[model samples]
Target: MPPRWPRTPDRNDPAFRRLEDFINFALHAAIYLAVNSGLWFFQLLNHPWDNLSIVSGVWLLGLVSHGCYVFILADYRRIEAAAQGNWQQELATELEEDATVTPDEAPSSPEQP
Candidate 1:
């Protein structure tokens, strides 16, 4: 199925796109906290300790974003490695197993008598 959301902006151009990404991260972080911490009931943005929203939002955003970016990179690396030769090694191992004889192998023939 197609993506439920619009395509993420390419990381190639980091000017306008990156700024938007930063803002989106901040909003998601805020909403995540609002939902999880029950702080939406309080005017979190107005309290003396309200800085938690900003701090937590940015912190969690950076942490989550960095982790997702790293995971994507790792997944890409794994795909590339498999494409290069890893799959060949796996296939060779499976074929080697097939080449082995096992006691469970079917009998070559049944006695006629």
Candidate 2:
């Protein structure tokens, strides 16, 4: 079964972004394996094709690059920290706005009979 997120999937979510990147890389690798294996099998059976190595080599490079980005280069911790900072700033701003409310703007309580 495919994985499910606890909440709605948003690009801003650091964990979601990291998982999505890994899923994409996994899909890419699976496709590369399936297609390249087929190509190599056929080539070996019917004599080697000149361009087959070139195609596989280029595709391998792309797969490696994707893996590198997903596993090594992605900064999920930094993203999460930035998101937390933004949330705290928003909370502080809301508290500040609430503190500035004048008596006329504030909600009134019901009068006792």
Candidate 3:
């Protein structure tokens, strides 16, 4: 089954972003495997293509790079921590603004004429 997010999915969500990146990499790898396998199978039958190895090698490199990025380089924890920090800062700012509002300066209901 496809994954579903508990809340609205946004690019700013670290978990969602990480999941999306991984899913994309998985799709890429799957396509690479399907295509390269088919190419190899056909090459074994007729041996017509001369640059098949070069093509597969380059594609494998790309797949490896993608895997490295998704599995090793991407840091979800840091992203989540930074997002949390931003949220905390925003909440603190809002609380400070609310605390600074005096009763006289606060918005009141419209006075009836």
The TM-scores, one per candidate, come to: 0.27, 0.68, 0.68
Evaluate residue 1 in candidate 2 and report its C-alpha lDDT on the 0 to 100 scale: 95
Q: Estimate candidate 2's alpha-carbon lDDT, on a 0 to 1 scale.
A: 0.87
In terms of lDDT, the best-performing candidate is 2
List the candidate 1 regions with Cα displacement exceeding 4 Å. Answer: 1-13, 39-113
For residues 41-94, what per-residue lDDT tens digits would candidate 2 score against the true structure? Answer: 999898778999999999999999999999999878667756677766666776
TM-score winner, 1 or 3: 3
Against the true structure, candidate 1 reaches a TM-score of 0.27
In model 2, how large is the Cα lDDT of residue 82?
64
Q: Flag regions of model 2 displaced more than 4 Å.
A: 85-113
Task: Tell me the lDDT of candidate 1.
Answer: 0.58
- Write down the RMSD of all candidates, one decimal each: 13.3, 16.1, 14.8
